[model samples]
Target: MGALMPAPQSKLIVRACVGAAKEAARGHTSRASKEGCANFEGLYQDSGGGVVEVSQTKCNIRARNAAQRWSMDANADGIQVFMWDVVGTLRDGFISWSNQATWVILQDAAEAEKKGLPFLPRRFHAVCGPGNVCILREEREQSCRTRAFASRSE
Candidate 1:
């Protein structure tokens, strides 16, 4: 009989952040030690991992439903004009701007409804600010405090 030959070996290298690399190295060392492997050699085995499947059609339908819900809510609040502007911004590929504008418009609409005042498109623009960045309430308060302290020091 002919002498048997050993299976060929291959190395797998992964590049990640420092934290992730350290975590992976720790797991590998633990597994190697548990299996009593010497110098982590000849211990490679392929475990069939399950694959995750996602349906693109379902994703699209969910996104459309969310948009319709937002539209209906805005219309009910008499703020469809502002919603249309947000839709236009989204269509123009300014995703971040659209998100901020939508959030500001919705918040204003809710506040106006609570106070029995109408939400104006002009108010939406003012709250959204230039470049469509909305300063959150916490951030606005922090800025005010900083300015007050600076004025007092001066």
Candidate 2:
């Protein structure tokens, strides 16, 4: 039997254009803790061990949990304009910008129609190609706090 190989980590970074919808921004990565217990000296301690619960409240739950959560939220919220711009370097000595997560964008658009949200500009157009320099522009404007909230599908 051959040894099992681990799945490769995604090289892509999925960034949302708009901000979170406000309700999702409050208490983000700010409120999180583990269960407590008494230690040898009868002092209060985290019984859950040193297992510090990372900010589980963040909208982005690492790469592992993002896709599933995003999909469910897309289905529920009926997202309107979800798009992706991919950037990759070519070994042929050229860089390129392409559509990577376009399928996810379509699914989100369909879900948006099902949920009754604005579904337009669902297509993604390339801005610039790969290189040492990459300048990006966002059509959807939002603050960090708002963006965080907007990104949340919940």
For model 1, state the Cα shift of residue 58 in Å.
18
Per-residue lDDT of model 2, residues 28-129, tens digit only: 111122322111110000111111111112222111122123221110011121113332211111111132221111112223346666533322222222
* TM-score per candidate: 0.17, 0.24
Candidate 1 residue-wise lDDT, 1-154, digit = tens: 1211111121112222221111111211122222232111111101111111111121121111221132122211111112344431111111112322211111122334466654322111112233322221211212221100000000
Write down the lDDT of every candidate, Cα atoms only: 0.19, 0.20
What TM-score does candidate 2 reach? 0.24
Clashing pairs in 1: none
Candidate 1: how large is its RMSD? 27.3
Please give the TM-score that candidate 1 achieves against the real structure: 0.17
True-structure lDDT of candidate 2: 0.20
Q: lDDT score, residue 33, model 2?
A: 24
Q: Which segments of candidate 1 are over 4 A away from where they belong? A: 1-107, 123-154
